[model samples]
Target: MAGCGFDDLPLTRPGPPLNAWGLYGEGDEYGRLNLITAQTVQAGLREAKEGITINLNLPLDTMPLNPTRAPLRHEIIHRTHCNDDHVSFNTQGSTQWDGFRHYPYLNYPEKQQYIYYGGMTSDEARDRSNHRCGIQNYAKKPISGRAHLLDIASFLERHQRSPLSYFDASTPIDLETLESCAAESRVVFKPGDILIVRTGWTEAFFGISEEERQSLPHRQKRGSCGVSSDPEVLRWHWENGIAAVASDAVAYEAYPSVNSPSIHETFLAGWGMPIGELFDLRELAAECKRLKRWTFFFTSMPLYVNGGIASPPNAQAVL
Candidate 1:
């Protein structure tokens, strides 16, 4: 658990996780992503034993949009006698990756402290001329690497644990729980690895009738579950050389944070880590159980929109 070597970057200096701003060099859009080296991708390629591919995306618009926000307005126009069509929908209406621009470093204590990675301010983002940290940087060259699937839900089920209710606000999967599951899976992690965790919340959410599911907004809550705001969890990730982390949960961190400096502050803001959420893992987890292996070659393609903040990851796992 030395440092991320961010201090070694040309424009960066030593700072305990706070100054990764210039780690990959000032104006660096691909922060921790730089960890995905040639060796990392090669290792992922080596894991494609049978070339079996699994798609990991939930159907878009499966539930009506939250009434507070406009519903996903989708429309398809067909050309007469030409067998052609055009369609449009929100990029984040389904599975997605929260990009570098999605969050800012809120831990800055100064009253006028408005800064982001590389010490850039929100004003920088306003200038459409320079969308430096936009998610498009990853899209221009999609993500491909080893994916470690930590099936937290199934692990709990096999042990006959009590039911985990996502709507209950306090159920959180912390580092120790994650380690227990990883050890059970017998999978070893490597640097630059893309991690995926399944909480079973998505399945339960989708199983309810559409009417019941949509009623979530009325209750002023959504049935969600995620990793706890445990510093140890973040430390473990950096120390293990994880490139990015994703989950089959809504926020990827518990809905109601139990502590300050939530994972979002340090991860997305501090280390420039990528966070993917709401991915469908029921099928992939089943495959991992059947094959007795949890590692696979993971690939994801976000829409190649210029300067976009976030986008759906048409993610897939090849085992």
Candidate 2:
């Protein structure tokens, strides 16, 4: 079946709410990613006219942002006058792409029953024997396509003459604000385009003192400012044919979501769309402003671990 409108969701029989289970195909791991066809890639390549490349990943050592995750560890091994390095860290310690298995819908809240994309269960995702709906699926065909940036922070400062006072949980970038930003920037949506939003979360995180950084995880209210989890946001993403969405915020959507079935569950599990978080978009945003262009060629390759739930996005943008 062709990609249906957002109103025609819940394509599969007895499926969860706002799902696109059978839109791509049964047992299909790649959800919106399938939209990045060869033609789409070729079109993206055309955006590399200036021969400039910008790295979109934050340093691996800039991790342990979440207290639950282990800190990055690096060790050096010396042998025969040669040196080798061994590294170990959480795939999601820094910038990362949340895979299909990363988030699952709570189908039966009473019994705590969870369901992943394409009707895969949590147990199925945990079983390493089968690599269904894993990050490796993305590795098989790396995500590469034209990307559009909605510079929300910059837009507000330039046009509205009022910038965000704080980058925290209290702040929410609503759909209307995002539309206004895009309109002010003259960005036109296109099928198979990777949508990137800059919310200034990363900049705020790094701007504080080292003492404050150390106290982040221990804080009782550790919420991030990001896109709103309103159903209308999902409708906009589906209607625009966005293959994936990335942002500098810790969570692509406001952390501790105000709505049920957060963007993580709906996008990652329902639509099979990847969600990138903690991306370093400061440099990219500066370049976009310098060039006065919001579109670029975006590419990302995740780790090839079978049954992997998430991985750092080795991403780049060419213009």
The candidate scoring highest on TM-score is 2
Q: Considering summed lDDT, which 10 consecutive residues are worst modelled in model 1?
A: 7-16
Angstrom error of the Cα, residue 308, model 1: value is 0.9
Give the alpha-carbon lDDT of every model.
0.75, 0.87
Candidate 2, residue 147: the lDDT equals 91
Highest lDDT: give the candidate number: 2
lDDT by residue for model 2 over 1-319, one digit each (tens)?
A: 6748888887875777788998877778999899999989998999888989999999999956789999889999999899999999998899999999888887645326898998888889889887999999889978998998999888777776555534344466788988998887788888899999998878888899999889888878787777888989878988998999999988888887888678988999889999999999999999999999988999998999998989998999999
Q: Worst 10-residue stretch by lDDT in candidate 2?
A: 161-170
Q: What would the per-residue lDDT of candidate 1 be over residues 279-310, giving only the tens digit for each residue? A: 89989998999999999999988887676767
Over 4 Å off, model 1: 1-19, 64-69, 111-114, 221-223
Q: Which sections of candidate 2 miss by over 4 Å?
A: 107-112, 161-168
